[model samples]
Target: MTTPIQIGLLVFPNMTQLDLTGPLQVFAAVPQFVPDPGAEIHLIWKDLTPVSTDAVMVITPTVTFADCPQLDVICIPGGYGTDALIEDQEVLDFVRRQAEGARYVTSVCTGALVLGAAGLLKGYRAATHWTAMDMLGAFGAIPTHERVVVDRNRVTGGGVTAGIDFALTLVGEMFDHPTAESVQLRLEYDPHPPFNAGSPATAPADVLARYEELIAPNKVRRREAVARAATNLAG
Candidate 1:
């Protein structure tokens, strides 16, 4: 029998729910698409305790870092939690160890910052939330402003919604284009946002400026955090 593919997604406090769920929804459909070597997905954390996302709901981890099997794909989902995760040496170490053996090392949104902190993105092209794109250089990464980026085995998605796209891309890579297409079709993945302001480039200048102002303080804090993480990784 073919060994089952293991996929682990890190879950932690203050994570954006969609960042984790979008890709998860896609991965969960793998069995229907690929029968042999089925996928086993795990929501991993430092411990088994339930953690709250930035949204209203809470998610309980299925596996602790200590007990997580070697994963074929290890994904880090992004959100405000990453601000703390970048400074967390324990989490960084776990990620580093997993990346050493994982077939695919991936991230969604600011989760890329966590991988960067773990010294995994250096010299690799990566994608992250647009607000955090500039910070990638601190970790020696070339930041790409795309919805999804695949460089070697490092797959990164732009922001929360992009997680779906990222996972579909991975599905294509792991199985086949037809499988991914089927998964997308099953999910009814067609998107037509009511507004075109999903991106700064597309948003009106005034709205974009105000949003930038709103996030300015948070950006300052994140910049400092990234700087500290990058320095620690360097030392």
Candidate 2:
């Protein structure tokens, strides 16, 4: 039998741990359904060292981007480092090259920011952390406000929680609805976030404003970084 689909899951410092591991659980649990010994899911990193999240979250790297085998899929996740990692050449390069090689490229939350930085968002209709979608156009992506946006082979999520939806969608794509449904059932994937504050529109006006104020600094930095990436691509 052919080797099972290989997935390259990119992780970085200050990433919302949930963004990476949540979708990870979706994919990792696939083996129980497919039971194909060849299926492999790798937690990739910039280096072999342990990486820390914004909330002091940390996870060891299993493979560096360089050693990342040509993958069937690549998953980029997001968190506090969204802005900073945008300007990181190492992170940008890894995302760019790996995405170029992968059959499909996906992101969760502001993880779309990384794909934007890698110049992969151009012409794609994608979703991201609502507050950050404005920056997507700076990189030429036509941003959409949805939990999951799929344009060609590029799949993006709205925020941290959307990772589960993103992965379930992919499972349906890679295999079939039965495969996805099976995995979803195993995950008890029924979701219900108690607060409506998850989306900009669903939340109260003042709460949205507060969120803007909190992320404003990162916005300035992310905007500049995206502009630079766009400029570099133009040249």
Candidate 3:
């Protein structure tokens, strides 16, 4: 019998729920679209305790880091919590160990910062939330400002909602266009926003300005976190 592909997603505190769930939904459907040896998804964390998200949602991890099998794909999703993760040695070490065996080391949004902290993104082209794009340079990564970026084995997504697009892209790469299409169609992943304000480039200047202002404090904290993480990586 063909062994099922192992996929692990890090479900940490304060993560954006969609960052993990969007990809989780996509990968969970792999068996329906593919042959017998399909993917098995695992929600991984330090323990089995329920993890709180940035929002009201709480997620329980199916596997702990020590118990997680070798993964074909290992993903980290991002949120306000990422700032703390960058300097978190235990979390960084766990990710580093997983990436060594994983065929794909991936992230969504500012989770790229966590990967960067693990010294995995050095010299790779990556994508992250626009606010943290410049910070990629600290980790020796080339920041690509697309919705999704694939550089060798490291795949990353831009922002919160880009997780869906990132997962679809991974499905395409892992299987084929038809498989990805099948998954997309199954999920009814059509997006139609009432306004074109999803991105800073497209948003009204005043809206973008207001967002920047709102996130100014976060930006400061993120920069400090990145600096500490970079220093840790350097040493």
Which of the predicted structures, 1 or 2, would earn the higher lDDT when compared with the native?
Answer: 1
**Candidate No. with top lDDT:** 1
User: lDDT tens string, model 2, 1-235?
Assistant: 6688898788777889888888898899888888764359888887899988867778888998778888889988998777777778888888887787788899999889788888899899999988788888877899999999989999998888889999999888888899889889998988787888877878999998988999789778778777876776676
Pairs in clash, predicted candidate 1? none
TM-score for candidate 2: 0.93
Lowest-lDDT window of 10 residues in candidate 2? 30-39
Computed on alpha carbons, the lDDT of every model, listed in order, comes to 0.96, 0.85, 0.94
What TM-scores do the predictions have?
A: 0.99, 0.93, 0.98
Tens-place lDDT digits, model 1, residues 1-235 = 6988999999999999999999999999999878788899999999999999999989999999999999999999999999999999899999999999999999999999999999999999999999999999999999999999999999999999999999999999988999999999999999999999999999999999999999999999999999999999899
Q: Measured by TM-score, how close is model 3 to the native structure?
A: 0.98
Residue 8 Cα positional deviation in candidate 1, in Å, after optimal superposition: 0.3
Clashes of each: 0, 0, 0
* For every candidate, C-alpha RMSD to the true structure in Å: 0.6, 1.6, 0.8
Query: Best-fitting candidate, measured by TM-score?
Result: 1
TM-score of decoy 1: 0.99
Candidate 3 segments exceeding 4 Å error: none
